[model samples]
Target chain A: MEFCATWTCPGPDGPIHEHAAAFDRGRERRVLIVPALFEEQNRTRRLLVETMRRLDAAGLDSFLPDLPGCNESPQDFAHQSLHAWRRAMADATAQFAATQVLAVRGGALVFPAHLPGHVLEPVKGASLLRHLLRARVISGREAGEQLTIEGLLDQGREHGLILAGYRFNPAMIAGLEGALPAHEGQRTILLSELGGGAALWTRAEPGEDAAQAAALARIVAA
Target chain B: MSALASDDTDDRLRAILRDVLGLNADTVASFDADTALFGAIPELDSMAVAGLLTEIEDRFGIVIDDDDIDGEVLETYGNLLAFTAARLG
Candidate 1:
């Protein structure tokens, strides 16, 4: 009944790592999903489960794949780039919906390049930032430090995206700014409260769902 | 919607922005609803965005999630004011 799992698949470059969840394979016509970032992927783990259940009961499937650089899927985190991650998601989509998809939060920045239309969730760049701040806070680092975009660009490029010595592509710095995640799930917004993003995080699994049905009501009603 | 109509909040938001982004400027103007923030602002990266949200939460005493008007309202100084107006209530 629970729908979350991790797997490895042949990628355009090499063995690609992925995470999948079936919202409802048999009855659902659409799949709501996304590929989130490092800490976010871990923080939303539990909430993703709850969200999948909600989608499954509603007869939909949600597929979440760990991006190239994230999770312990035997992939090179340093080699992970935006394009590779996009391709990975595209591959995951081939396995899920033959056609439709939906994603929330930062996932909205990515959608089918060829899809007829997309449904954006309420999540935005700022939302992703919130999750990252929480990550800093939990790490016992001063969450109060106001790290800037320019600063990241400078630092990320200077060291070529090293997170405590982990190699992240410098390009990812700019990509984060331009990410306008799109989805097929009828433009909705997801909010979190106490431990909301806990699930996606390796250390904490979020227990709160800050999303309201009213956000996408207009889209559904239209 | 009207630049948050509060001199106090405006000044506070500037301070937060400067603190979060590590700026030495005493003031920043042109924060409107249509202002493009995602890519235009040099300091407003994903990490800074998170820091800004946390700062707002502590300052305004409100919980912000992705679903909230953060992304849209935060596009510019004006949008932030609008968001602050709504949250201040």
Candidate 2:
């Protein structure tokens, strides 16, 4: 329903509890939703949550957990990396006893690959990084500051750079540059398959499509 | 590289615009070569341009150089389509 539940993940120092939105009715089919990363997370939360609602209506239970540094979590976003997120998700899977996963957008990069489920519009970590860098470049241009993707990436790798208001550490930058979504044992669901005009993640603001959500739930529930 | 049809590029570009800008089907279908983008559409702000470029690259399977992009390239629907068609060719 809401953040009425918490899942324990191994933190850098010790085990940490993170807020999770769950639709649990003790259904036989439980889906762990790995939401889109970064700004895309905000852009697609409603769509994912709507989809979860439909899944629940279809007699499926689902859990949408926050990444350690995201949402209501007390962790610092800058200190997070792909490795840490993957571990956190893996722990989420175990703790929730999720039978299937629903990795959306960049979440594909960190979803537990060992489980069979669905990946919606999976994107490479490099692409995600490029999108962020390009946004920074565009904003820089508008502000009369010349910034190149290559230059920003170099700086990010050496130290850390704030892209689109997100402070990323060197490890996070490096990890994102090479992270690719795992495909084995997962069904790739493209936007086309969902019969949607465009993915919510691409929009400048967050929006939702009820038809798209229903289509996704039907696919997952089927 | 094999060339892509001009009509195909036009359709794909329109689709990208519709998806990226969240334009309705009628609005996208009504887009002509002279249809202004960027400043004309409020949704096509600087942030959206980033996503638009990345989606164009992904759909068209061509890498876009940052130096090659400018206001001129995104001035109109025609200009963007022509540029993508040129890259495909």
What TM value does the first chain of each candidate achieve? 0.64, 0.97
Candidate 1 per-residue lDDT, tens place, A67-169, comes to: 6656645677766666666666676666655355545455556545544323433355544543553433322223345544345546766566444235656
* A144 Cα displacement, candidate 1 (Å): 14
lDDT of each residue in A1-222, candidate 2, tens digit only: 553579898777888889988998777888999999998999999998999889988999999999989988878898899999999999999988999999998899999999999999899999899989998887787678888999999999999999878899999999999999986889999898887457899987788999899999999999
Best prediction by TM-score: 2
CAPRI grade, predicted model 1: incorrect
Residue pairs clashing, model 2: none
Each candidate's fnat, listed in order, reads: 0.09, 0.59
Worst 10 residues of 1 chain A by lDDT: A196-205
Query: Which segments of model 2 are wrong by more than 4 Å?
Result: A1-3, A12-14, B1-8, B26-36
* Poorest lDDT segment (10 consecutive residues) of candidate 1 chain B: B65-74
> What's the TM-score of each model vs. the native?
0.54, 0.89
lDDT of each: 0.53, 0.88
Candidate 2 whole-model C-alpha lDDT, 0 to 1? 0.88
Chain A of model 2, TM-score against the native?
0.97
Q: Which stretches of candidate 1 lie over 4 Å from their true place?
A: A1-13, A113-152, A163-166, A182-186, A190-205, A210-222, B1-89
